[model samples]
Target: MTTKNLLVELFVEELPPKALKKLGDAFAGTLADQLKALGLAGADSVVTAYASPRRLAAHVTHVWLKAADKAVQQKLMPVTVGLDASGNATPALLKKLQALGADVSNPAAAVAALKRAPDGKAEALFYDSLVTGATLDTGLQKALEEAIAKLPIPKVMSYQLETDCELPGWSSVNFVRPAHGLVALHGSTVVPVKALGLTAGNSTQGHRFEAKVAKVVIKDADSYAATLQQDGAVIASFAERRAEIARQLAAAAAQVGNGVRPIEDDALLDEVTALVERPNVLVCEFEKQFLDVPQECLILTMKANQKYFPLLDATGKLTHQFLVVSNISPSDASAVIGGNERVVRPRLADAKFFFDQDRKKTLESRVEGLGKVVYHNKLGTQGERVERVRAIARAIAQQLGGEALAKAADTAARLAKTDLLTDMVGEFPELQGIMGGYYARHDGLGDEVANAIEDHYKPRFAGDDLPRNNVGLVVALADKLETLVGMFGIGNLPTGDKDPFALRRHALGVIRMLAEKDLPLDLNALLAGAVPAFGDKINDATPALAEFIYDRLAGSLREQGYSAQEVEAVLALQPQRLGDVTKRLAAVRAFAALPEAAALAAANKRISNILKKAGDVDAHVSDVLLKEQAEKDLYAALKSVVPQANAQFEAGDYTASLQTLAALRAPVDAFFDDVMVNAEELDLRLNRQGLLKSLHDAMNRVADLSRLAA
Candidate 1:
């Protein structure tokens, strides 16, 4: 039962930086999980993952040398079938025992060893045996293979390796990259395992250029990371390397005072970390004249094309300097800095040129050019789409504001997509809306219009900010609604994860603007209003689109910490004004906390079922038909409570409204307890049904409380 730590590593060519973290995590997690499942690793075992530009490794502590033996009980056959009337062993039973590796030389003794147990309706014969555990070699091999098979490789490269035997031949191997070496050590002992057409060993190569030694020898599982770092001159752990790079970047930025710092982007940092084995952060700069270009353009070019981090001053404006993460460290770093500056000069020059050339043409002039650019085959060109958005924006602004706001929204929506025709946006599509804002300003348009054009695509992703101003809000809503209605109209709705048009995102954006801004707009009316802009190009998808938006709203509310019961109850009403949804949810929660919530909810559920079965029963109940004392009492309670609840509901005091309805719990309970809804007389049954129908209507005005019933 002795145990020791295990270490495994795979050295290969450079891996895709974008997928490096995912691959490393999957490799270590799957390998350790397999070992635990196979009983080769204990519950307290700790696993550490190591990844670099050229290697992926894992270290696991407390792994057993061999799994423990397990006791197994297997059912043979029914006693009636396996044994005969004479109480003697049958030929079939003897054959079955022999196949299970049981001694059959004395059939009677074998039969005596089998135990009889009651199974279902009859007795069955069961065989007990001890199954041997797997050794470390076999277990690790299986775990290694399973881990390799589960790697989330972006792409697999196929290469040929020379055969190990005395034959002059090659074998093809498919992996993330070409495998050069593998190390597997169990407490300093080399474990015999093979993978990717290579046998495991204790040696691996590191830092293709800066290694102090040609080969790094991992002495033991405990010293894997330290040994690799000292001998190979590489930081094996991806997290440690990323932290080192971050620390170096901070030091360099602080050295160049004036509150200068590198731009913050985790994805860029991860990619840079994956591109280097040993990180050496160095400061480099382009010409100061490049600052005349918009900082977004310059930053995008540096990060996207050169994989560089552009520095920004305290004002969040791009500076002339940037940071570069070098894989190799040298004493004379001046040469490296100069080389990087020289390499990035041409890139910044290109961005400056595009920005200068783009401002020459006005966004107004670019409007005519969008007519040739196709948006969707079914939907017309960008020019036509712009008109539709303008129409929708105008209508929304009129409802939100007057003709003044509508006029501004119409201009912003018309020119929003004109950025797609600009040279700067064409080269860097990420800067479409951003560049539009800049160009609109150059056209002498007010910040209101320019900002709206830029922020029309705001809240692009999750947690992104919504529109800044009212005009921007109108345009953003119009822009998203146009896409949603257009796509859902043409049957281009998103399926599962395939959101080709980003309909889900568009729908969410619309919901966020409506709910967050607390706009006094109706969801159904908004969707209906946008349909006329499409003319003959779309079908009436309002009903389906409403359901889709409500579904997104429900999921979003749940993620915001509202329980499923609260969300379902409020969203069940499909409130026309999404702005009131959160208010109603708060009310429902407060009402659920009331002492009578459960009883009222249960009674409400019962009343709903009765009304449904009593089909077409009016809510009008004649006091003369109230023959039962319980019915009279319930009707009197409704008369006292309904007026107050309805007044609170009209005044937007939903919590008070629901709480007022809680007063009917006792009377509702008595009505159901003392009276049968389906009485023998037709008139009596109809009157009882009418009373229940009235109760159901009043209770469900805020939410479907029946959903709260267990």
Candidate 2:
């Protein structure tokens, strides 16, 4: 079979920067996958995706001009139905064979050639045939249509194209953007394919202004990127363009000297890469007075509004000069730099004005305005939510550090939501908690209270840092707890992935703080404390909420490499103090490694089943009723081992506690082997049950050993 590399490109208007990467990957992946499925491409074929601001393209290696013919076997109806008792073909069988493109004129011969096989309880007839492979022209057209249909377009645009008629009829086309050109080449030959109401060709338009020619004619499939870069003056590969932009940014920053570097943000880099075809990094500067405003404000305005990369000094402080990735590289470059600087000055000035106007009124004054701002229709105003958070925070603080911490937490919680009313935060909701801290400090509040106000929303996502101080910790916990409980109470629990309130994130934040911080607080007690703040506004959802949190913890632990059995065993106890969960899991893991672990785990499972049927057996063994010597031996062993294990457990040595019980394995085996748990005498049976119950209780202090039975 002859084969050649294939190249396909779709050129259109500028694509959404954030969605370009996904679109490119999906386009290339789906096209290659469809070709492979059709047998036109082998499994080992390589696919390369190229995307720029105005195009998505793919180059696939070893794509055959026609798929290899395949032998196919298809099952037909039962043999009895296909042929009559006398072996004459029935009309149904002839119709089926006709539908399958088999010869139907001689039905008896066709039926005679059919293979017989057992399909379930009945014998079925099978037809074997050779299927001709699809040609590249038809296959490529289908693959291109499917790939375009499957693109992860953020939005679609509809437009009309001029028809090839002298009368000037227009044909409507719906696509991510208005289709300008479509290029499809199999090696050097143009594959006749049409998409988005445009026919495939060997040529495509490149960089609007910098292209040496308006249209760069792709000579061959292998030369797509080279031709675009050399003749069209556009870097075709997204990754190559991103690397070029990074190299240019680094080189430009080095020219400024003193270890200055461009701010590192991969998302920003990707967006900039998608915005320009020929990236030319230029250093631009705004007035130093803009730096007097918070660096976060200036940096955000420059990056978000202008798509500029702010330079950073050796100490990670933002510099006045920033870098811009321009589409065209001019020899002088002064106009580009000056134009970008002029564009960003007003954006920075607006941020500064908002910050100045916000600090004029104290956070305390803003607190009153939150009453008018609706937080949730069911939860009432932000003022009401603040009061609830304050109550919860005060309770947590007092439990953690008494009156001084309580006062600080309460003050912070009261002012935490006040930033929502500030002009700066109102304009940029991402800076809500941050602006509150700044304004709190401006209001002459102490560091303890101001820091707590800001850090209340700390650890916003996975791996984020927790609060820096005890007051901040209390406030953060209280804020998260209030959201979890209130939402859960109103039957707004997260279903599937539709957690509009981010309840799962809130639960994870709670778990991370409880486990990572290892605070002396009990999770159940903390949840109980949070629930009362809602009063009659919520139901008693603490049980369900606790289960959800534990489920999240289990998933997190498993992701951290703990086995399902290990996680199940530890979480089975529903330990109120989540801080000790890791220690218990470690102990369970250690115990599972013991030589006697499998046997003990099995015996524990047996004991649990026996005790459950025995109905409320007391832990007191009543040695007077011990008839079998094995039962007496086991009771004696428990009396000796339980004390040491209890002592270790009391000392917070869970591993030692579990390890100490390994000695009981032999006695337990003997008791179970020789003794009949349900004896003829009630007293003896109860005593045996009590002995097993006592054994069960000691073995599972750290985790439910029965869960490790398998």
Candidate 3:
């Protein structure tokens, strides 16, 4: 078979920057997958995706011009229905052959040619045929259409192409954007394909202004990127363009002294990359007085409003100078730098004004404004939510510390949502908690209270940092717990991926604090404490909420490399203190590696089944009822092992506790093998059950040993 490298491109208006990467990957993946499905591409085919502001393209290696022929075997019908009494072709058989595109002139010969095979209870007639392969033109057309239809387009535009020499009248088309050209090439030969009301061609438009010519002639699949870069002066690959922008930003930042560098944000870099064809990083500066505003406010306004990269000094302080990525690189770049500086001055000025006006009124006075802000319809105003959070934080703090910590947490929670009323936070909701902390400090609140207010919303997402101090930890916990319990109580539980309230994140936040921080707090008690704050607004959802938290915990633990069985073994007990979960899981892993683990686990499972059948056996063993030596030996083993295991468990040595039970393997196996648990005598059966129950209780102090059963 002969093969060639293939290329396809769609030239259009600028694509949505955030969705361009996904679109490019989907287009290339789907096209190559379709080609491979049709046998036009081999298993070894390599696909490379290229996406720019104005185009999406793919290059595939080892693609054949046409698929190879394949032999197909199709089942026709039961032999009894196709043949007559004489084993000759009947009218039905002739009609079936005709439908299959078989020559029916010699009906008898055609019937004989059909293969007979047993299918199920009846023998069926099978038709064997060689299917001709698909040509490059037809295959590419289908692939292109499918890929276009499956693009992850955020929005679609409908337009009409003007009448041309090939088409007589205007044709309506809908696409991601107003596509102007489509290029499909199999090596040097152009594959005839059409999509979005455009026909495949060897020519495509270059950069709107900087191209050497109006149109770029792509010679072949291999030369596509080179030709575009040389003639069009555009970076065709998204990654290459982003890398070039980074290089320029670094170089431009280096030109400025004092080790200043561009603030690192990949998302901003990608969006800027999608907005330009050729990047030219220029150093631009604003007035130094604008630095009076919070660096966060200034940095965010610059990046969000003007798409500029704010430079930072070695001490992580925002610098007066910033870098701008311009699409045009003029010989005299002072005009571009001056224009950017001029444009950003007003944005920075607005931020500074907001900050100055906001500080005039302390956060203590703004608490009244939150009463007008609605937090939720079922849950009352932000004012009411603040009270609930305050109460929960006080209770948590008192439990974790004493009077001083509780006072600080209460103050922080009270002022936390007050910042929502500030002009700075009102303009940028992302700065809510942060601004609150700054204002608290300005209001003469102690550092402890100020830090708590700022860190109350810590760990907004996975892998985020938790609150730094005990006061902060208490308030953060209270904030998350209130959200989880309140939402769940009102029956607003998360279903599938539709958690509009982010209850899942809140739950994980609570769990991370409890497990990672090793807080000496009971999860159930914490949830129970949060319930009273909602009063009658929420029902008692403690049980269901606890289950949801445990489910999330199990998943998180599994992601951390614990197997499902290991996690189940520890979580099955529903330990109240989540801080011990990791210790329990560690013990389970260590116990699983013991030579006696398998036998002990199986014995525990058998004991559980026996006790369950016996029904409510007391954990009291009578020596008089022990008739067999095996039963006596097992009881003695439990007496010795139970105390040692219990001592280790009390000392918080879960690994040692579980390991102590390994001594019972021999006696446990002997008891199950030699003792008759279900004896004819009722007293004997009850006594045996009691002995097993005591053994079961002892072995599972650290984890549910039965869960370790294979």
Off by over 4 Å in 1: 87-98
lDDT of 1: 0.93
Against the hidden reference, what TM-scores do the models get?
Answer: 0.97, 0.98, 0.97
lDDT of 3 at 356: 89
lDDT of 2: 0.91
Candidate 3 clash pair list: none
lDDT of 3 by residue, 429-537 (tens): 9998988888888889978888888888988888899998899999999999999989999999888889999998998999999988999998889899999999899
Model 3, residue 167: what's the lDDT? 50
For 268-329, candidate 2 gives per-residue lDDT tens digits of 99999999999999989989988888788788878888899999999999898999999998
lDDT value, residue 199 of candidate 3: 89
Output the TM-score of candidate 1: 0.97
> What are the lDDT scores of the predictions, listed in order?
0.93, 0.91, 0.91
